[model samples]
Target: MEILDPQNTVLTNAEVYNIVVEKKKAFSSAPKDHRASPALRTVIYETLTYLSGSPAATQTEEQIKSLIRALSPYKFTGAEILQLINLRPKTAVEVQLVIEECEERLTEEQVNEIVEIVKQNFPIQSETKNSLEAAEG
Candidate 1:
């Protein structure tokens, strides 16, 4: 396959998870003879399993877009924004860890604001959800 727009976009894990899920559904619905290879099927299954157990599973499009818009003023790098979405940090320390040079770039209040923004955009994953998943797993 040829590469088109090699750097057209940077996708968060949630977006990747959604895409993988769609591909998995398509693969399952295709004729057996026309289905993807065994290796591809294995990859899809493994990826789905991992993503389901991760924070990405709970992420939604609206949340992600809102988060990006809210955080744009901070001028964080794409990688940092992606990390923020994936980790859903709840504390200043966590925000500091994700954003490079936080000590210099982001004030204490800014860091705290980022934390609140993350919390507001992606609420903490509930313990009940985790427990239910653990039980199911």
Candidate 2:
């Protein structure tokens, strides 16, 4: 296969979840027996099942954008920022894990602020859990 864009583009769990959900919808709407190959359907089902439990299930595109904007001042790389958005870390330790050279770069207060921002600003929604299962099946 010819290479398309040479640079890698990172996607968050929510983006992946949304894409799979759309594909599943398209597959279900397609004519019978002509459904996405069994293996493909299975993959969609499994992807939905796994992502539904993560923060991605309830996350909106706007929310993700807002989060990226909120954290931009910290000057983390796209990958690092995406990880923070995807993981929704709730503690200083978790923040430390996601960011590189945490001890040297950030003061205790900044770490606390990042933790609080993540914990308070982004809440994991519990409503959509397994909501798509019956439809997919």
Candidate 2: stretches off by over 4 Å: 1-8, 127-137
Error of 1 at 18 (Å): 0.5
The pairs that clash in candidate 1 are: none
Model 2 TM-score? Answer: 0.83
TM-scores of the candidates are: 0.84, 0.83
Residues 45-130, candidate 2, lDDT per residue (tens digit)?
A: 89999998889887877777778788889999887888888898888999999999999989999999998777665764553445
Lowest lDDT sum, 10 consecutive residues, model 1, at 1-10
lDDT of 1 at 88: 88
Span of 10 residues, lowest total lDDT, candidate 2: 1-10
- The best candidate in terms of lDDT: 1
